[model samples]
Target: MVKQIRAFNQLKELALSQEILEDSRTKGVVTALYEALKSRDAEAIQKILAPDLEWWFHGPPSHQFLMRLLTGEQESDFRFVPHSISAFGPTVLAEGFDQSRSIAWVHAWTVTDGIITQVREYFNTSSP
Candidate 1:
């Protein structure tokens, strides 16, 4: 009975450790992506995102600047300043306003294996 209990406890500890490690790895990727966005570092952005990344924007269709930034069609003149960031398992949510531009944005990211595979961005349309 004693040996069985010890074995179960060891297994539980191992599972917990693995979960923490994955969380750390996911946060690292999310943080790096935001840092790259702030600096407008195209190379860093490319490095952190998956090659086959899928991103969507929710706002007026007239607002094409954000899409341009993501597709590398145009350079970003705005810098996003995240006010709050939270991680729920492999997903990370960042909400803030742009310091360089008058835009409030909420970014939801899905990270897998240390790479951002999906992104959903919501921007305030009231801002010019």
Candidate 2:
């Protein structure tokens, strides 16, 4: 019975350590992504994103259009500021507000192997 308890404790410790490691890696990827976006550095963004990354936008077509502008796919002067950040499992979420446009947005990112593999973004669909 004592041996079984010892083995179970070891397994629990290993699982906890793995969770911590995953959380750290997720934070690193999301931090790099946020910095790249804030600077509008396409090269930096590309470094942290997987080559086959797909980003989904939840809103009207107008929101998708705005995302293109924000990501530099289309020419625009708007820049987003991330005000809050949180993580769950393999996903990191950022809440941002653009005071000039009076808009708030949420971006959810799925990070794997230290790279952002998927992104889901929601524009100002909720009242502040």
* TM-scores for every predicted model: 0.76, 0.81
Candidate 2: stretches off by over 4 Å: 69-71, 126-128
Compared with the true structure, what per-residue lDDT tens digits does model 1 show for residues 9-123? Answer: 9999999998888777787788888788777888999889999988888976655565677687876566667788777779888898765566688888899877899989888
- CA lDDT scores, all candidates in order: 0.80, 0.79
Q: Against the correct fold, how does model 1 do in TM-score? A: 0.76
Backbone clashes in model 2, listed as residue pairs: none
Best by TM-score: 2
How many Å off is the CA of 83 in candidate 1? 1.8
Please count the clashing residue pairs in each candidate, in the order shown. Answer: 0, 0
Which digits, one per residue and each the tens of the lDDT, describe model 2 over residues 72-99? 5777666666787777769989888877
